[model samples]
Target: MTALTTREQIVTTADRLFYENGYEHTSFADIAAAVNISRGNFYYHFKAKDEILTAVIAARLAHTKTMIEGWEREAPNPEARIRRFMHMMIANRAAIKRYGCPVGTLVTEMAKLDHVAREDANKLFGLFRAWLGTQFRALGCGADADRLAMHLLARSQGVATLANAFGDDRFIRREVALMEEWLTAAVAHATPRPDNRRRQH
Candidate 1:
């Protein structure tokens, strides 16, 4: 694989630091050191911390869009796509156990700082919400799609939070299994039952 460009390297390093350490705590020098670049090079690429923050958020948004779209293509149906999303936690259980959800932690930190880029950071969740909502809609959720999307998102965030707090792989697996069951129940409920009576409409 090709090495990341300097600017890309800075954003990549900053993204990890911002998640592992929190935006407020990760210094410009820290990112520079991670990328093996000088402070002058860093400043050349980014005039201020907020600029780096914007780049990080933008990178995250782009990557997340690609990821969900890939899931949409890989899975045969909406239910499968949604399951792929829930399975993500298990796929990255170790990271979630160590640092919590990256999106959750970074967005929460940005909000606490009242940083100007908070909304940009938050678009990560928004992207997932919208994608999940589309999947729910395809599952016949109709008017309730967004609500179901938010419901699953909220529950997953809670799982990530607790998983980090407890650092338990078993907990993550158990919660994910429960989420799958929830999805099955939701789909069943959304699917219109066949009726024996003639059309009322």
Candidate 2:
């Protein structure tokens, strides 16, 4: 195995700590200890704990984006894409049920703690939401595409929270199934009619 670079060490340690311990609970010292580095060396890579957390958040978002791309590629239509999104969310049911959505979890817990961190977290979420909205639009999901995008995110977070609270994967799977049903109905209803009118029959 290639020896880890300093930047890699810092980020890998931060990611592990952020996941194992809550984002709020993990400290720079914890990260340093994890990597067997001095606090000063940690500071060389990250000026503050918030900086490390921001890096961790960015890495996590990138992983999630890759997952979304995989779903988007395989899903043939808006409705199917929506169902695939539900399945993706449920794929992490057990882990999300245990620790919650990583981005959602960190943002909810730490966004308000610092200005820079909050802005970084907000941008991450904006990118995620926009990606979904754009996919819905590309698939010709109708006028309510933006709303559906938001609803999908909101419902996924709710399902994760419920799963975490109950310490059970059942609720996570159930909510994802419910969201799939809701998406199918919504997308079918929203598909433009032959007359090109917004009114439903």
User: lDDT score of model 2?
Assistant: 0.71
Write one digit per residue (lDDT tens) for candidate 1, span 134-169.
888878888999999999999999999999999999
Tell me the spans in candidate 2 whose CA falls farther than 4 Å from its real position: 1-4, 38-40, 192-201
Candidate 1 residue pairs in clash (backbone atoms < 3 Å): none
* Model 2 deviation from the true structure expressed as Cα RMSD, one decimal place: 5.9
Cα error, residue 165 of model 1, in Å, equals: 0.6
lDDT of 2 at 92: 74
- C-alpha lDDT of residue 16 in model 2: 69
State the lDDT of candidate 2 residue by residue for 1-201, as single tens digits.
233487777887788677658777888777788888777766777887767777777777787677767665666554565677678667777678778777677777665566467766776677767877865675567666687788888878887777878888777777777787776676565544332212222
Worst 10 residues of 2 by lDDT: 192-201
Best by TM-score: 1
